[model samples]
Target: MVQKRKYAALFIGSALIVQGLTACSASNPNPNSTGTPVATGTAGDKAQTSTSGEKVTLRVMDWADSEKPFREKFIKDFEAKYPNIKIEYTLMSVDQFQNTITTAIKSGDAPDLYPIPGNMSLSMAVKGEWYQPLDPYIDDAFKNQFAEGAFVEGSTMLNGKIYSIPAMASVPSTLVFYNKQLFRDAGLDPENPPKTYTEFRQAAKKITEAGKGKAYGIIEGGKQIGRWKLAAMDWSALGGSGLNQQSPISLVTHDANYDGKEVLDVMNVFKGLKDDGSFHPKTMSISAPEARALFGEGQAGFILQGEWSIGVWKRDNPNLDFGVMAPPVPDAGQKGFLPRSSYSPWIGMSKTTKHPKEAALYLKEYFNKDYQSVLVKAGDRFSILKEVNESSSEIPQFKQYYDIAQKYSRLVPNPQIRNPELASVYGNYKDVQPGVGDILQGVVAGAIKEPNTALKQFSDIVDKSLDTAIAKAKSEGAKVDKNDFIFSNWSSDKNYSQQDYKSIQ
Candidate 1:
């Protein structure tokens, strides 16, 4: 079974407390714009105190579970070097991790550092007003070493301040992990994976017929609510760039923008799969691990997963014979809509930190070559540094995915969570639906009809959600600079396909 990581927060706590002025600056009229505090005091700050001392303890939490042998060893190695830093490790489910940290912050016991998503990073940076600014430490040498998107320098920058740094950077594109044995049984060439949507569907059909009673051609996830594999992966494969990446400010929250005839066609293909009964009924609720296990045991032909799957599979079954391929495109020569999956839980030090210099030193070490290489080797994670990719020992199967990412990958910009106030304008009708995945599952199962309408409704809500979020941010002192947020290079012209459900029916 696959092991999942949860929320990881970094906290350095000391018994000593230093009080100071807590007031919004005159330069900004917004009630929330408090100049990031410059912390004073060296004795209790995490940066100043060595963890080797019996009295000093440095609290570090990571979402990476025990299954990640590499991270475990890395932590042990770091602790061995910094004997004074008595690091405490805590494991929490992904669902509970964020809430746990938020509650700790409320109780004044938050960790000194923690991992945060892109949306969370922006939100906390603007709302918390606690992380220390590392500008003083970001010298020319440091700046020159990092890549263009390493810090997400453009997206996470707020009011001329940067709050977090990504340990690795890459846009995540979906990957197809198939059992070589199963492919051969189905009369397909395991070495030559499908290149287009038509070929993919044809392969799935043959695999299903070959599996007989014991296996399936494909098993899509159907649990949760409206957002399922059919919508996320299948639609993306059919060339649906629902959300434009050209603009840093415009996030895909609404269906009207990207949910025309093309999306419906994507849904139709998925519906056809359900009609053929090639998927498992429990696909929605059984979890990703279950799906992986099924494929590993030769009960399923193909599974769609992120980059980590390769590392995970190697850990579980060292001898499993499988091949990794890019998800199929709609055409033979054209590129598919590959969603950027390069994600790293980011680290940000609260501006309220007393030992800013010390924290920067740690950050520099964190992003150093030696440490990153170890993580990549053990964690099966891709690094942000271009040099790392050029020199990585990743297997050829995984390397192929990396090579493809250079040209076809796209990031989801201005995610909905980053700016909640603009929810309505951006088409966000409700808080992110935990059960959304299940809704998509229902469509795949024939339990729900009009899949396009359902998807559109969800999309519409997200679109308005962003519109409202941006307006509120502007009203609340956020600078509305169009050039910075807009993606002027993106084109939605002839290459895109349009669908009409009524005409098809």
Candidate 2:
């Protein structure tokens, strides 16, 4: 299947770095965290419900290492309050979680809470009855705590049914994580990293040459090939490829463009880096965690990843100097910007869960102001709340990220959001084998000599899959069309607004 990055996978290392809440003042842009956990949400719970009975264990599965420590602490605090409910949590790789969760759903044994598969659309999740309606459990008081547009049809709500809740703010998953020391050693300026595609390529080759087997130019978690797919999507967007930042489908032409020059050019650079011996020798087998660790060890000059690594490297390898920058773009300059989709829930209640009230209760508190404040205090993620985001602005690293995202991440047109009925378009869409990620992997590994031909073939197959999906949705008496994918008013830099959706009608 054509794969993409999961909503929460990008922030795995955003965990452990935080020591405690820092004493902040308006003057301190980079407020330092201290030595005690004091988020008021956990250690200072105001509403404690002591239920005395047999402890109810809720099964929860996730893929975010970033949320692990906080999740454990939250459970501990929650258990102290309830005293009758326990959380049984499972953390796994994105691939493993999706595979196991899918099997569990098919066997009528799904976990109490699980993330929707990266490959599944909201419509598909709804059609398969993967999540139970949460509306019954959500009180207006708890609901009002969320940001505006937290629930929408074809997203958190489907067909008037609330299926999920917001977990994190929308942020692009791709950014350049580079070693400052490596740049110095390679005779490159640490202050000015590569900005254009050619410069990026040359810099990698130069760094690899200087390393002389001690390090490499770049590293990737090649085992999880979606890493490359995400890099391609984000970097290629600057080329004005028209391909959606999240998928192979184009936002402009409403056609599959996996073979388009934008993506293929990015793929070629990835392949060239491999050919130049700029990739770490173990890049093909290492996981992202392993790669990040290697990068911390100064074994790689650069790693294409998210902003959260700033926290990880600072804590783990304090001596390793590094910097963050946007992925290198085409020499001609950036022609497009990244598209920011709305907040997507990383976890939702399973339809078969027995502890509906308890699970719903936890869901409501998951993104409350208290927890959000803690998240910002720890520099984990940008919260959906304006006030929490304002607090995060005091942290220098997060402030830097805010500037990058501001320039790159703009809301784009989405057909599913415009017309809820069009959700079937994604539900019925079939993903072909050796998808975007695998194709890039094959070319890099020398398994595919003709990368261009492979990409074109994949594009054709995916395009055909779209046609088949449209036909299937139509056959079921849903008004669907290929043309629905296009928003004529939207541009590469468009900030799609609510009014934009209304105007189409």
Candidate 3:
């Protein structure tokens, strides 16, 4: 799930206090600003303290309040290990963090370390030099410690330089969680879940029929547009086609045919369920969290969600019996594809940090196996280190999901679409008319009669957006070619490869 920004103020603990002047000034150096005193820690070496025996305090910021316990533990351990250094951890709401951090950075008062917000594209951040490249501090031995695909291009790397490390393993948002007891009560085999879309729809009908208004076959929150888009992308990929599954902007490659067939099929599935009275009555009215709550309360038989939901369900409904399943495919024997990026919630150093050496030390320790274990065991997030995950004591369900992510997931399309300049142009075309999310919501709510027409309109808007972005990029002296958008030999059956991109070029 993308980390959204929060707008409300949160009461942080006294231990994590905000130091220095609350107000900004031209001459009064904010300790959090990039202009603070620089530490002289050598690249790939341990941090050294000042000759005067002064303590070095580094300010770190993140928005995950749920992970506060783990963060506190890490801080305690880190300070114990390095007696000369101290860490002041600050937890903020997502919205406030992004807003305040951006403002602080502009005023030269950015935190020493913070997470790269999900809404902020990595390419844009790299281009703006907001993050300090970690290549200098990360030696070959350090780089080799992570799994082969842990550090991915367009996520952790830009122009062959590393700027950040992934805070957790990539978890695809396509997995489905279903109530096994609900299936059994509906006279369906709990052991044999639906594999094809036809079977899935039939199962939903049976469950709903059995409930007679007390339960729904499936549940989804239509109020959140992003949830709809995610569901559409997941189902389209299962149907062997996807419009924007690979990237924010759909690239019309030569072999990648997005004629709206796959999307239409997906939309029709929801439409069929809606018409059959299989979906929750409030599906279109609630938010994603509310939908999850309904599902946990045994109001729905199945829910399409990510691995993270496992922990949520366990915490909220301890007695609920649930099982994870791969998304339904178009055909019985066909395999479902999972679209995933390389890294998420990337942690990095601020370019203007006063203590680069101490920050590097903190980062190195952050990825340490011992520290990663705390994140895995306490936070329930998958570890980026291969060894930690392989030997994890996490629940068997999460381990199973991790295995699927490792074997079945494929990286999204080329890094070109991440270009900040191109993204700006493409974003303008997204809402030229009702977006895909709006169209899908309308279809499920019985507001849209023709899914094909709506999909075709969305496709045209995307094509025009791509064209506009290409033209603007060229005018700005960016060496972008229109042909880069075309992947001649690409196929949904297999993952996209450099060879496919090379074939078109």
Candidate 3: count of backbone clashes, pairs at least 3 residues apart or interchain: 5
- Each model's C-alpha lDDT? 0.46, 0.66, 0.59
Give, for candidate 2, the lowest lDDT window spanning 10 residues.
16-25
Across residues 1-505, which tens digit of lDDT does each residue of candidate 1 receive?
0111111111100100000000000010111211111222222233434423443344544343323454444446555554455445564432345567667666777666654421243444445554555566666566555655444322334445566555445434245778788789999999998887678778877888898868777764343121243244324433654433222122222333434554455556566666776675557565454566566677777776544455555556556788877666665344345433222225566544444544554555555555455434432455555575456435555566566554464443333223323222222122333222334566676787876666656556544544555576676665542232333333322221112111221
Order of candidate numbers by TM-score, starting with the best: 2, 3, 1
RMSD (CA, Å), candidate 2 to true, equals 6.0
TM-score pick, better of 1 and 2: 2
Those runs of model 1 whose alpha carbons end farther than 4 Å from true positions after fitting are 1-55, 65-67, 96-99, 107-109, 117-121, 129-144, 152-154, 220-258, 331-336, 339-345, 350-365, 410-438, 445-447, 481-488, 492-505
Off by over 4 Å in 3: 1-69, 75-112, 117-120, 209-215, 221-223, 242-245, 248-259, 281-294, 331-336, 342-345, 351-358, 375-379, 403-434, 442-451, 496-505
Query: For every model in order, what is the number of clashing pairs?
Result: 80, 0, 5
Best prediction by TM-score: 2
Candidate 3 local lDDT, 1-505, one digit each (tens): 1111011000011000010000000011111211212221222234344222568889898655434444566677667666777898877644456578888888998888886653454555655668888887667767777876555554456666777676555555556778888899999998788988889999999999888898989998667554566567656765656433334333333322333577677788888898989989999997655677799899999886555455455555768888777777775445346555434426778998878777877877776666555445431466667777666435556666667555655554444433323333322222334656677889888999777877776666556655665677677676665555445554554666545544554
* Tens digit of per-residue lDDT, candidate 2, span 423-477: 6766777767666778877877778766788777777887787788789999988
**TM-score of predicted model 3?**
0.74
